[model samples]
Target: MNSKMLQRQLKKLNLNPEEGPVNKKEWQDLIKLIDVTYNEYENHLYRSHNTLNVATDELQRLYTELEAKSSQKIQVLDSKLQNIMSMAPCIIMWLDNQGYIEGCNDYFRQLLNFNESLDNKKITLSDLDLHTLQVRAEEFIKSNLQQTSFTKQIANYYFKMTLNKMVGQNKISILGFDVTEDFNKQNTINQIQAKAVQSSKLAVLGELAAGVAHEINNPLMILTSVAFVVQKHIEQNKFDQLPEKLEKIQSTITRISRIVNGLRTYARDGENDPMMPVNIADVILESLELCVESIRYQNIEITFDNQMTIPAIVSCRDTQISQVILNLISNAKDAVLPLKEKWIKVILRQVEKNVVLEVMDSGSGISLDIREQIFQPFFTTKDVGNGTGLGLSISNEIIKTHYGRLFVDHNHPNTCFTIELPLA
Candidate 1:
């Protein structure tokens, strides 16, 4: 039935081109008239199929050309609308009174992982709701007005679900953003903050330990001095019997003193070191010392190639710089641990009034697509509990403050981070 109707519609369209679009208030009405005329002609399609004179055929041809031009004009308007909808960044979807995804844009399909060849008439939001998305949609549609819009966690991240009712059509359209990265980042930040507080508490305990160590050092020194004096007197032949005991006491005191001092020395750095002319080489060495345990634990061998003279330095915050180095080395260690060959290199070079500290490792390098976005705050490739994405961003910010630059080096083998600091 529709085929016969289609043939008549084509015939009418073929003839109508000879006639032009009648000027009117709006072009839509004229276009509709042309379509309705075709539909009517389709009713009598078989009766007059291919039965026309040369003059009638000529008239039909003229009408067909005019109609084709008119149709083209109408299509241009539709194309404009489609272009707008399809190119939109926001997912735009439409549904009838029945909560189905009747029409959707390219962005909308991508958001839902909908097929590229998805058609407007065939699919619905409910159809594509593989992960209980349909259930959420149903809940939204069931409600008259959902002011308290909430979030949905799918896979490892969160997405905000919003629904808006089409006022006239009694349909609903939803707009959504994949808040997975943002949500995960926020949670990590919270965890980091909590960890920092805990670390501060531990640091305070370390400070107390330092005080205890300081207190013990004085008595330890006095005992050692007295024991040494007694040992010397005994050895001079006045008290041979007591000399052996005196020597042992002095040895015990010295041992205790060493333990006390070591406790203070290994604390989490006193405070952020004041800005100074810090030797870049010295910082690198100290950072190596700081990360030695971690590096060994990960079994990642490190080679430090310092091409910079110890005299080559930069004026910057020493502790922050140290933290930056620590973070970078830690990142490299973590990255290289999974690889078959565990090797990390800390290469420092003095080039053109600047010092560059490069941490290169035989590790899984970053993907090319995401390489540019790696420096963004709260960006990470590590799993949930492994890393707090802030390391590179914080390092970048610290370097920037000192007129330095920190960036990933992709041209080299494996993963690399290069920090360049201006000497002056």
Candidate 2:
């Protein structure tokens, strides 16, 4: 969806924004959207810089190129500003400290609605003030110089005025920038850094969980085996009086074992790299087998569509890919809560040179606004303490390590998350 449409939808949802911090948050949300849509621009910034802070010739060249682009944008804005001057509905002016019209853009001239060009090129801030009514014009002028930046109602339009001390001289350069498009083109890269930090913490937690699971699995296995034997003895009429209790014990042990194992792998960092020309179909089947028991327990139907006859271009760590797939599948299952429609589709296809594996749920589709932020670590849509929000982010990183792609699709009624790998 376009920004305007999204904004209108937000308004309809009564997400009517307030000023100050609330407004900042709204802009931050928009900034995330911009990042997703403008990933290539960011990648350019990265590939052009010395990320390690080591100044290199390539970095310098990239920096120069970026500088050139910024200047180019500025020049375009400058020309557009002139055209807008006459067209603006407000009284706009570029004034000197001595209260003379240093210049006026088109918006200023156009507002007069007069083709008769005023020969007055020497109009100043004071002249505009007289036309603006001086009941508080003196205070406005004084405050304008004092504040360095502000917005005020002038001629029924919002005028955001800013003052800068022209370098090399002690004169103020006052100008107005149209907040129309917001021009919030600031490239805030800290999101990725924040994500990396969150992922690292989650990795640490996963590692601890893995160790605990491994340590307890053996004991749990032994206990579960003994419990089954006892349950069998009860079934054989050896302990018919305690049959119910034995069954309960057996069931509890199995549940705990599964939960423990779940925690262990959740924290893994793909410690081993074992790869071969493995059949991706086999991997998909194994992933399903790993989750089928849980899905069956919840009465959820599973669909596996593997139409990809083409082989993958690269061999990746199977366990790692499985972990990523399992994470996505788990999320899909959890999303279809309380709904009668309990179907999940796992589709694998070869699109050109890439292998695409998609897990689509029958739940409500994801919102476009949060879709980009979904892969951001620690930025979960789940309730507080319910999710660490690192699953997709870490999964994305894992895919990146393997030189693949990960994304969520909201183009359909069901939400689809896809992972693409290069064909080997």
Candidate 3:
């Protein structure tokens, strides 16, 4: 019942469509076979179309499933990120170009005592009641700087705030770290250091007590001699010599007064003194007055070379600066006292924008191995019971606090220590 069979029948009869058939039953059978063959072709086309439709539906279903899974995964990842940001210890805030608070982490909200939900409110920096922070942010936005950092105090706590501008965007991000504990610890350390400085001053005074007594005794003896001469002149009616003798007594008393005043000034606590502009040379000379007698008593030749033609002014606490100088000179005296040369030279000069002071002793330089350890606390080359070993270390710290430097001058031939402070 296929096309081949139909064709064979037509050929057997040798008939054409335009001519009549010779046998009617054979022609009728041929027509029925043709219909069956056409129906079979149509059924094949229908089956192929149904299979294609089924494949398309399966592909669409698979795409939908993949899309759902991907969306779920993305949601989970976003949730994790949010949780992490919320739980972070530091404060984080995002701001718009206009300085309005766009968003913030949970810590930021908690720090500002923001009880209301962020989603329900449009917050700005002004609403936080921190005027300093608001002003700083406004200033930063107006500035050409890309980022800024500063410390801010809130209640009893301190925060180190860092603000970064977003490149190619009108936004800024602020990060705040709590530094209260560090601040308190530093304050306590400063207090202890101050006490130590005071204690060192007292110890130095104690060592110089005998020399100070001798210095005062000389002036007193001169005063007593002058008084006796004045009394004899009065008894003998010799008024002409009285004026000269009285002048000598006045000068001696003045010397004693200077010594007493210098001692009084050096002995008290100066850590809390206000910083003022002072001529550094004057401070050095004043410090020398307190210890010059002691150095002389040891028969050490001390010389000062003042090369600075003009006054070298600096902003500092004079007492503390003087303490550092005296300590250095005292150390220099000790270093060279036993040496054959037995001399200490102090040089003051200006180098560029800094005032440099050098204390050199006529001793062989400190050993290379111990030079590095000299400035460390409790590290000393002096024999036991003779030194606290905190002198150089404290002096170094004091100079650093003044934004200056204290170190050994390796270039010098002998043992030399240098202090370099910026000119105010």
Indicate the TM-score of model 1. Answer: 0.40
The window of 10 residues in a row where model 2 has the poorest summed lDDT is 180-189
Off by over 4 Å in 2: 1-268, 271-276, 310-313
Query: Model 3, stretches more than 4 Å misplaced?
Result: 1-78, 117-126, 220-250, 268-275, 350-354, 401-405, 410-413, 422-424
TM-score of 3: 0.72
lDDT of each: 0.68, 0.64, 0.85
TM-score of each: 0.40, 0.39, 0.72
Best by lDDT: 3
- Tens-digit per-residue lDDT, 1-424, candidate 3: 4878878877877466667646877868878888898998899889999999999999989999999999999999989978988999988887877787878889877776776766756677778887788788878888899989998887667999999898888888888899999988998998887777777777777877887888889899999988998999999999999889989999998888877877877887777788899998878877777778788888898888999988989999888888888889878887887788898888999999999999999977888889879999878777987787888888998899899999998888998999999999
Question: What is candidate 2's CA lDDT for residue 360?
Answer: 93
lDDT value for model 2: 0.64
In every candidate, how many clashes are there?
11, 21, 0
lDDT of 2 by residue, 296-324 (tens): 56788888998867654458877577678
Better of 2 and 3 by TM-score: 3
